[model samples]
Target: MSQQTTETTPARLPAAARRGGGPPWMGAGMPAEKSMNFLPSAKRLMGRLRPHRLQLIGVITLVVASVSLSVIGPKILGHATDIIFSGVIGKQLPPGTTTEQAVEGARAAGNDSFADIIAKANVLPGVGIDFDRLGRVLLLVMLLFAGASLLSWLAGYILNGVVQRTVRQLRSDVEDKLNRLPLPYFDKQPRGELLSRVTNDIDNISTSLQQTLSQLLTSLLTVVGVVVMMFVISPLLALVALVAVPLSVWVTKQIAKRSQKQFVAQWKHTGALNGQIEEAFTGHELVKVFGRQREIEASFAAKNDELFKASFGAQFVSGIIMPSMMFIGNLSYVAIAVIGGLRVASGAMSLGDVQAFIQYSRQFTQPLTQVASMANLLQSGVASAERVFDLLDAEEQSPDPVKPAPLTDRHGRVEFERVSFRYEHDKPLIEDLSLVAEPGHTVAIVGPTGAGKTTLVNLVMRFYELDSGRITLDGVDLTELRRDTLRSEIGMVLQDTWLFGGTIRENIAYGNPEASEEQILAAAKATFVDRFVRSLPDGYDTVIDEEGSNVSAGERQLITIARAFLSNPSLLILDEATSSVDTRTEVLLQRAMAALRSDRTSFVIAHRLSTIRDAHLILVMESGRIVEQGTHAELLAAEGAYHRLYHAQFSQPAIDVDEATPPPAVPGAPLLRQR
Candidate 1:
C-alpha cells in the first residue's frame, strides 16, 4: 500500500494581530513607550510584601535605633572641640586670672565680641589642654558610631530575607497562572516573550528590591533623625538646611515621571528581542536550508537596536535626578556655613554647637542624594511588576465544578451535539457539527488541510470550550466533569513527538508513573521500541538530549506510541502517529495500536487511506462540515469525496520513476517518496 502525505495549512496571524492591538514591537513604526501607572503598580507590588509585615516592623525599629545613635555622635565630638579651645584661650592668659578678668581684658583691647565669647566659654584662667576630659568624650563618640554601624548591618540582613521570600511567592503565582491560561492564549503569545516575563522580569524585580529596600529605609530614617538633632543644637541653621528639601523633591519627581515610561519600554523590547532570537535558533536548520540567514540577522539587529535605545533612555533620564539634587544641596550648605559662623562669633551660639550643626547639615543632604539615586532602581522594578501583574490579571479558563459528575462505570462513548467554535468573533471554524462514536468502535477522520480534522479532536479533548453547544462522554456533559478527571481516561499520541532530557525509561514512564518495570518493557516491545533500544549501548537507560536529537525520527515516534500503550486509557487518539516511522516500523506500530484499541473507543486522524480500511466508520470532512460518513468500502462504492481522495493518492505519478514500470518495493523504505 502507498503512503499519502498530509500538508498543513499556513499559519494565520494571531487574533490579536488580526485586530489592531498586537504587541508593541509588531507594529510597523518604531515601538512607542507605554505610559506607566506607577502609583497603582507600585502599590500592588508592595502588597506582595504584606505577609512579611512582622519582619518589616522589626527592621524599622532597628533602623531607628541605628539612625538615632549616628545622629548623636556629631554633637558629642563638638563638646571635645570646646574643651580644647577653652584650654588654649586660658593658657594664653596670666596665671591666677579669673574668667571675669579675661573678659575685661578683651574689652579693654576693644574686642567686645571676643569678650562675650570668652565669658560664655567658662575657660579657667591658667588651664592648659585637658587631655583626660577630651579622651572620655572621644571614646564615647567612637562607641556611639560603632554601635550604629552594627545595628544598620543587622537591619539589612533581616530585610534581605523579607524581600527574597516575597519575590519567591510572586514567582510561584506567575507559574500557576501560566498553567491555568487557555490554549488559545498560548497560541497568540510568542514562547520567548512569555519566558522573559517568567525569568527575566521576575529576576529584575528581585534585584531591584534587594538593592534598594533596606537602603531606602535607612536613608529616610537618617533624614528625620538628623533634622531633629540639628534643631536641638541650632534652630537657625536647621531652618537654612531645610530650604533645599522642596527643590530636591521636585527634581526627583519630574525626572522619575519621564523615566518610568522608558523603563517600561526597555523591558518590553527585551521580551520582543528574546522572542526573535528564540524563533531564529529553533528553526535555524530550516533557515539555513532556505538561505535566509541574512534576513534573520537583519531582523535581530533591528530588535537589538530598539532595546539599546530603550535602555539608554531609561538610564539617562533617571540618571539626571542625583546630580540635580546635589547642586541644590550645595547651595544650602554654603548658606548655613556663613550664618552659623556669624552666630558663633557673636556669642549667640557656642563654637562647638556651630561645628555640630554643620555636620548635621551635610548628613541631611546626603540622605536626600541617596534617595534620588534609588529612584532609578525603584522605577525599573515597578515596570517589571506591572508586566507580571498583567499576566496574573489575564482571563483564565472556566473553573471546574465544586462537585463534579463522576464516571463510575467505564464505557467509551463520545457525542458532539450541535457544536460551534471560532478563533475570532467574525470567522467561524466549526459550526453546528454533530457526531457520535459508539462504545468500542473505531472512528477515523480523514480530510484535507484546514478541514477541521484537528479541531474536532481538540473539542473532544476539551482543549477549547464550545461556542454554542455541548460534548459529552458516557452521557455526562464534558463541562460537568473536571478536566483532570476527563483527561485521565484518554491517551493521545501526536505527529510531533516530545521527549524530555532524561533516560528512555523515564520518558516512557511519564505516561503512567505508577507503571511497573515489567509493564514498561512489555509496552516497549509491543510498539517496536525494544528492538531499537537493545541496539544502543545503554539499552533502555540511554539518555536523550534536551532536543531529543540523539534518536532517529522513527525511534522517537515508536517511543511516543509505547508511552500511549503504557497509559491503557479507555479512549485513545492517534493523530498522524505513524507519519515519521519507516515502512517496517509503521506496520509493527499498526499492529500494536490494533491490540491497544480492543474493546475501546478510538479516534484516528490520518491522511493515508490504507490505514483506515478497517475502521467501522469513516468521516470525510471539508470546510468544517462532515460531507460524507460511512464505512471505507461503502464510501468508496459511492464514488464521492472519499473516493476522489483515495484515487488522487494512488493516481499521482512517482517522482523520477518510469511511467510504465512500478517502483521497486524495499523493506523499511518510505512508501511515498518526496519530490
Candidate 2:
C-alpha cells in the first residue's frame, strides 16, 4: 500500500539544520516501514520489565486465581438452578412464585428468621420440596460469585500499581536519555516532536498498561479454563462451541489486516499535525505580518483532513470485531442449545450440565472477541513504545575521559593545530586551520554569514570536536579535559539570547548560581542591565516569561551579558551580542564588553566592521580560510578582503581598492602573512 509522506514547511530548514531538538514528525513523520516491525520493539520493552519480575509474577498469580474463580462460577450457578428445578418438580409448584416467598426462602436458607424450611417450601402433594438443600445450594452459588468478584478486584488493584510503576520508570529513562543525547542528534529532530514523545507517547503507554495489562492475562486464562470446562461437561457441546473460534478468528483477522495500515497512518498523521501546529504557533507573529493566516489555515485543514481519514478508517474497521464475533458466538449458542436439548431429552446429558455448558460456551467466545478488540490498542501502544525506545537507544554524547585533567592554571592561552571540521561530512566548513591566541588577547573573527565564523568558536568551546588535529588550552589537550571543566572556563553569549523564566536578578546570577546579592548587582551594573531594571515596576525582581517576551530585545541581550559577566570566565565568546540593540544601546553594551573582555582571551564573531576595528587581531574569513589576519590598521593597509569588507560597510560608494594607496601596517605589529 502507498503511504502518505508528511510534507516539510518551506520556511523551516531541514531537521539537520535545526539546532533545537524536537520530535521527528516536525521534520518528517515516522516512516511506514519503521512501524511495520513490532517484535524488536516488543522484545526491548520486555527487557525493561525484567527488573520488576517479582511484582509481575505476583500479578500473574493473582490473575490466575481470579480467572479460575470466575470460570468455575457458572457451574456453581447451574447447581443452584438444579436445586430450583428439583423443588419445583417435587411438589408441582405454581408457575408464578411470589417475590415475598423468594425473600422468605432466601431468609430461611442462611438467616435464622425461618426455623423450619418445610413451612416455607410452598409446594403441592406427592413430592415435598427439599427447601433446606435448595436454600444451601443457592447460598453457595452466591458466595462463589462474591468471591470471584473480590479476587478480580484485588488482581486489578495490584496490576494497576505494577503498570504505573513500570511506566514511571520508563518516563525516567527517557528523560535521562535525552540529557545524554548529543547536539547533533537534537539538530535533526523537532523540539515539539521530542516533547510529544516524552509527554504524549509515554502517556499513551501508561494508558495501555492500565487498561490492557490488567485484563490481558485474565482474559487468556478465561478462554483456556472455559474450554477445559466445556470439554469435561460434554465433548459434543464443546465441539459445537469451538466452531465459533475459527469463524471469529477469520473475521477478526480480515478486519484487523485492513485496519493495521490505518492505525499506523493514524499515528503518523497525528505527529505531522502536531508538528504543523507547533510551527504555526511558534511563528505566529511572522504569519500575521505576512498575511499567511489563510495559508496556515489551509495547510492545517489538509493535515486535519488526513488525520480524520486515518483515524476514522482505523476506528471504523477495528470497530467491526465485536459485532461480528458476537454474531458468530450467538450462532454457536443456538447450535449448542439445540444439540443439548435433544441430548437432555434422551437422558444423555443432565439439565444442569447443559445449562452450565451454555454459560461456559458464552465465556469461551467473550475472551476471543476481547483479545481481538485489544489487538488495535496494543498495536498503537507498541508503536509508541518503539518510538520511546528509539530515543533511548540514540547515540549519546562522546564520553568524557576518565580522570580528565582540569584547567589548573586558567591563563586562557588557546591554540588550534591543523584542525578540520564539517557540519555535514562532504561539505567541509573549516579546513586545515591553525591559530594562536596568547593569554588575554581579543581575537575578533569577521566573515560573511556562512563563512564558518560560529563554527570555529564551536570547536574552541568543544561543543563540536575537530574532524582531525587537536585544540589545546593552557598547554593541555581540550579532548583530555572534562566537558564541564572546559565549558566552566569559557562563557558564551550568542546572537540568539536565551533567558529562562525568572527575575532579572536571578537571570543575571544564572551561570554563577551561588552569586551573592551584591555580586549580582555589580554584574548587572557593569552590563548596564541596572539602568533598565531600575526603570521597571519591580526593578531587579521583575519576572520574565519563558521566552523573555516581556523584555525588549536589547534589554534581554543586556541581561545575558550580565549573566556572562557574573560567570567571570577566563575565556569569553560574543557572537553578534550587540546586534539586537540600537546604536545608543550598542555603545553602552560595547563599553561593558570592553571591561568584561579585559585580561581575558575572548573570541568575538562580529559582522559590524566598526565594532571590531580596534580588536587586537582581526581574522577575516572567506569560504573556509582566514584570507586576511592582522591588526585593523594593517588589514586596511593591505587593501585585501578585510580592506574591501571595511570599506563596503563603513565607506560610502564602493571604492576601488586598486586605485587607493594601501595603508602601512602599524609600526609595532606587522600582519602575519598566511602560507
Candidate 3:
C-alpha cells in the first residue's frame, strides 16, 4: 500500500524537525515495514518455549499430520469416484446381453453366437446390476473420512489452545520488556500503537489458528502436496491444469499489494482514534471543568472520519480478492472440463482423471485467495513487531563499571562536583553547579521556574547522567551502582502519586512485596492511611479503580507516602507540592514526613520555604545555576536569591510569577548542584 504523508501539528514537532520536518518526504525511507529483523522478538518468544515447547510440538505435529490426512482423504475420494465411474465396476452387461445367457455361458450350458457368448461371459447381465458391493465401498470411504475429520477437529482444538497460551506468554514478555525499556522509546512513539502490539496483533495471530490458517508456509505446503499428487495421476493433464496458476497468482499479487497498504492505514487510523479517546477519557475531569464537550466531540469526529475512510478502503480491497478468485476459478474449472472431456472422447485420458483434476483446481484457488489475505496479517504483524522491537531496542542507562561501595550506616552526605548537564546538549537545563549536604543534614532546593530544583534531586537519584561531572552519595559516584539496587536504595515522594488498580493492601505491598502484615500496618499508621482503610466497607481489602480513580487524590497521595515509608530507604527525595491536605491529615502527614526523613539523607524540592527551613543546607537555583547555598539562618543573613524567593512568596497575598512561574520539567529544576 502506498503511504500518505501526514502533516503533524507544527507545534508538536521536536526542535530539529520543526526546523524543516524533512526535505520532501518526512520520516520517509525509514522502514515502512516495521523492524528489519525478527530475531529479537523471536528470541524473546523462544524464551517462553522452554515451558510450552513440548505441548506446542505435540500440537504442531498433530495439526500437520491431521490436516494432511484430511486433505489426502478428499483427493483419494475424488480418484476413487473417477475409478468407479470410468467402468471399474461393470456390473451390467452391454445392450442385448441377457443375464440368463451370461450365467448359462459361464456354466457352458448355452448354445449362442461366439460374440454373444463372449459378451455374456465378460459382463454382468444388462439390467440387473448388483448394488451390494458399491454400498460397502461407500461405507468404507465414509469411515475413512470420519476418522480423518475427527483427527482434524482434535488437532484444531489442541493448536487453538496452544496458540492462546502462547499469546498470553507473549503479552507477559512484552509487558516485562516495557518496564525495562529506556524512556526514549516511549518518547518517539504513541501509546495507542504500543497497546495495539500487546493487545491487537497477538489476537489477530491467535484467531488465525482457529482453523488451518492461510499462512504462506501452510498454504504453499498444501498446494505443493496437491500439485505433486496431480502430477502423479497424469503429467500431461497436470501441466494443462497449471495453465491458470500464473493468472491466479498475478490477480492475488495485485489484490495483496493494494490490501496491504489499506490494512496499514486502517491500523494507523485506529491507533490515532484510540489515542484521542484514551486522552479524552483519562482527562475527563479537565474536560468537564473546561466545559469542552463539543470541542472534544469535534476532535473525536475528525479522527472517526479518518478511521472510517481507512476501514472502508481496507475492507473493500480485502473483500474483492475472494470474488475475483472465484471468478477465475470458475473459468479454470470450465476450461479443464471442456478440454478433459474432448481428450477422454479421443481416448487421450480417462473420466476418472478429469474428475480428480477438478478437485485439484478447487484446492488451488481457495488457498491462493486465502493465502493472499495472510499477507495482510503478515504486514500487520510486522508493523506491530516493529513497534515492540523499537521499545526493546531503546538505549538503557549504562551499567556501572565498578561495583558500588556498600555503606553500612546511613550517612546522608550528598555532594555534586562541577556537575553540568542537559536533556538536549544544545539547550542546557543545568549549567555548571555544585553543592554539598553534610551527613545527618537536610538539603532544600528552591528555584523559581526551571531553576532545576527537581533536576537536583533527579541527579541525586541518578535518573540521568551528568554531562561532565560526578554526583556522589557518601563519596560513591551515583553511576557506579546497579540501577535497580540504586533505586531501591532511595525512597521518593512526589507531587503526582500513582496507584494501581487493586486492594489497598496490594497497592501498599507494591513498594515492598515481602513486607510483613504488621510492618504494612505500621507504615499505614505512620502515613495516616489507617483511618481511610478503616473507613472502607472492606477495610484494607477494598479495591480501587485504575490509577486509583475511585479514590480521593489526598487518600491516594497518603497511600503512596505510606509505600515510601514502608520502603525505609537510606536516602529520600520529596518533591512536595505547596498544596495542602485537610488540617488533621496535614498534621499526620507532617509528623510522618518528619519520622520518615529523620537520620536519612533527605533532599526536598519545595516552594513552601517554611517547610524546609529546618534543613541543614538551603540551595537556591536560577537560570540553570545555583545562586546561593546556606542554612535558612545563613541565607537570611546573605540576603540573596533565597532571601528574595522566601520573602517574595510571603510578601503579597497574591504574587504572580513574572514571565510565568517556571516549575521544573521532567528531571525538573536545573538543580542546586551541576551533578
**Backbone collision count in every prediction?**
0, 9, 11
TM-score of 1: 0.92
Give the Cα error of residue 584 in candidate 1, in Å: 1.2
Indicate the worst ten consecutive residues by lDDT in candidate 2: 1-10
lDDT of 2 at 271: 66
Where does candidate 1 stray beyond 4 Å?
A: 1-36, 654-675
Model-by-model lDDT, in order?
A: 0.85, 0.77, 0.66
Q: Largest lDDT belongs to which candidate?
A: 1
- Tell me the tens digit of each residue's lDDT in model 3 across 160-264: 666678667767767877766644345445555467666776675455443334244356656776678778766776777677689878887787667666666
Between candidates 1 and 3, name the one with more favorable TM-score. Answer: 1
Global Cα RMSD, each model: 5.9, 10.4, 9.1
Sort the predicted structures by lDDT, highest score first. 1, 2, 3
Worst 10-residue lDDT window, candidate 3:
1-10
- Between candidates 1 and 2, which one is better according to TM-score? 1
For candidate 1, the lDDT comes to 0.85
Per-model TM-score on C-alpha atoms: 0.92, 0.86, 0.81
Give me the displacement of residue 480 in model 3, in angstroms.
Answer: 1.6
For residues 552-623, write the lDDT of model 2, one tens digit per residue.
Answer: 998988888888999998998888889999999898888888988889899998998889877899999876
